[model samples]
Target: MRIVVAHNRYREAQPSGENTIVDAEMAQLTAAGVEVLPFIRSSDEIPTMPTTAKALLPISPIYAPRAQQELSRLLTEHRPDVLHLHNPYPLLSPWVVRTAHRHGVPVVQTVHNYRQVCSSGLYFRDGMICQDCRGRALGVPAIVHRCYRGSRAQSALMATTLAVHRGTWKSVDRFIALTTAVADHLRDYGIPDERIVVKPNAVPDPGPPAPLGDGFLFMGRLTPEKGLDLLLEAWRRHPVGALGPLRVAGDGELRPMVEAAAAERPDVSYLGQLDRAGVRAAIEASAVVLATSTWHDVLPTVIIEALASGRPVLGTALGGIPYLVGAGTPREPAGTGPASVASAVRGDGAATLPVGVVAGEAGWVVSPDPAALAAALPVARTGAAALAPAARARYERTFHPDVVTKQLIDIYADAARTAPRH
Candidate 1:
């Protein structure tokens, strides 16, 4: 099937998993014998836009005429069977979906973040998960709290964009949610059950399971939301004991704190930001991977990568972490619906929500609080060997490229059938 993949890449200054996922998926499709055409824009290009255009960026999320025209041109020329969208923000707006409809091409969108319901796209504010804007009429609460990049004006513009384009988002042929929890949350927002498809992100298989490594690994942005502080506090309280030191990779605002913790404790080591190879090596060198995010993160690539590397993940029981770690039960964790799901809805949802199988069955899932995580540390260290196989098994069943690509092909075929028969 011929498809057009459209994405607005986040800036590289703070590398994004969305950017990596889009690039990887395109490569996967090509290798799977599908014809893929990329129509991409980057946040890095914002400064190069004309001065007049730069001045209007605050409202660009609502509509970008240039993006519309360019996409229209591509649609007319390529006549793609489907237009697959990832992220369309400041430059490429939701209008692209409308534009695809105008050209008789059906569109499929992937929900990489909570952008439609939250101005910050993270559902996070003040160092906590904040879902105040979910299902709200105008997302006024986001603006009131300066949720987007800590700017009220910017948040207001994003709120306006979300409010105005709600219909455009719902009109897409399909919404590919990164997890079942995310899919359920979309339903709570009134998106139709059939419209949302649960599809987890995949990483290339890093080969057969390697021998269990010593210690654990933490990688990704060193930010509050990522649970950098929470991880350190938990480690300081738990202190690894004798299973080797905790190796940290990645850099951000919390570097000084990480460095300080390293200096103060012999069990913590800050390796700074590692390149892709370094990250892969670290995963193979660790007994478990830490995804200690305190926010409702869509899904951290690290968790999947760790599983692919045959290492179990010990993540907080929040957002997609529980789902990735394969913890909890499948009966739907409590409070995942509109009445209960919140930016700070942590422990309450662990029961009724989808937390998958517990650590022994798959991987570990603990609360984001230091005390909770500290308590689970020993369990992870002790069961690392028994959990390694389950982790890799999960990777093969769900995230293997061949597996995900087959799902993608089916979705593309379904979307193609929905295209206007003009």
Candidate 2:
């Protein structure tokens, strides 16, 4: 099958998991013998654009005439069977859906976030989960609160673009929801069950996973929503050197908090921002990986990375973390001692959620709190060895390119059947 994949990449300095996933998926398709065409744009180009292009940048979110013209030429020349879209923001607008429809091409979009209704696409603002603009036609609340990149003007533009493209998004032939939580979000947005498919992103298999490592690694942006503070508070509850070591990475608004924690505790160390190789090295050296986001994070790639490397994840029970960690599956544990599913018991003797360090299980999914995470830490450390195989097994079954790419190909075939027969 011939497929055209389009995406507007986020800036490189910050890095975007979506960009990484898109590239990985395209490579997976090519390896599987499918013809793939990538149409991509980068936010890094905004700084050195020609005067004419820069002049049209402000309105590009609503309708990028240049993108439409270029896409039209590509589609008309190729006549591809399907058009799959990832992120379409400042340069590649949602109008690309209309362009695909005009060319009689079925459009399949991977819904990455809550952008359809919320201007920020995060449903979070000012360090809190805010959905004030959910039912509004214009999302005036977003503009008032300066939610999009802390600029009222930019928020207004994004909000207006969302309001105008309501039909364009809904009219998509298929929506690839990254997680069950994302699928639920699409349903709440009025997408029918048949039009939405649950397809998680896949990572490359890193060959045989090394033996379980020591300590725990928390990588990603050190922001309020990423829950770096909560992790630290829990770490402080334990005495120094009591629960192995904790390594924190990434830079964000909460860097001071992370640095302070590292300075105050010998067990805690800050590794700053990591390149892909550095991240892999850290994962290999860690017994468990952390995904402690306070917001409704759709999917944190770090959890999957740890799984692929045979490291169990200690994730918060929010958004797709539970699903990513293989929770709610009706499979029995592997063996005795750390192999059984563990319930995080509070210091006060209260029990919280369970950690599945079992046969098909990945790890623990605790409540989004310091206490729950604190209770789960020792359990995760104890079960790291038994959980290592389970983590690797889960990666091979679900997030491996050998598995998810076939599901994607089937989705493309279904989408192609829905294209207009003009």
Which sections of candidate 1 miss by over 4 Å? 239-243, 329-357, 419-422
Q: After superposition, how far is residue 186 of candidate 2 from its true place, in Å?
A: 0.3
Clashes of 2: 0
RMSD of 2: 5.0
lDDT of the structure predicted as candidate 2: 0.85
TM-score of candidate 2 versus the correct structure, residues matched by position:
0.92
Residue 242 displacement in candidate 1 (angstroms): 3.5
Q: After TM-score superposition, what is the CA distance of residue 36 in candidate 1 from its true location, in Å? A: 0.8
